[model samples]
Target: MKVKRPGLVTVIVDLNFLNVFLLIVSFFPKSKFIEQFGFYFNPTPSFFGGYN
Candidate 1:
């Protein structure tokens, strides 16, 4: 039997950045959950792609 030791370097990959980020952001009470009261209700497609 044998074992391999981990190197000093490491790599991390995930598909939940937004979810994780939001969770971390939630830790701070100052974070705003959403913009306005009902603006997020009827989300427009343009808003989703507005980042670009």
Candidate 2:
């Protein structure tokens, strides 16, 4: 179902998500931060860079 929110509210939400995504994709401990975002699809450190 589609719900409608005020334009200003939608923009704010999108900006928040973008900021969070950028933080997760940059900096050290990226894996830890991404895991915290509830995105379980990314491979963990053990499975990354062929360590697994």
Identify the candidate with maximal lDDT. 2
lDDT (tens digit, per residue) of candidate 2 on 1-52 = 9999999999999999999977757654446666686655544466546743
lDDT of 2 at 18: 94
What number of clashing residue pairs does each candidate have, in the order they appear? 0, 0
TM-score for all models, in order of appearance? 0.29, 0.44
Q: Rate residue 22 of model 2 by lDDT.
A: 74
- Candidate 1, residue 39: the lDDT equals 22
Candidate-wise lDDT, in order: 0.47, 0.72
Worst 10 residues of 2 by lDDT: 39-48
- What are the C-alpha RMSDs, in order, of all predicted structures? 9.9, 8.8
Candidate 1 clashes between residue pairs 3 or more apart in a chain or in different chains: none
lDDT per residue for candidate 1 within 11-36, as digits (tens), equals 22243665687566556543346433
Candidate 2: segments with Cα more than 4 A from true spot: 1-3, 28-52
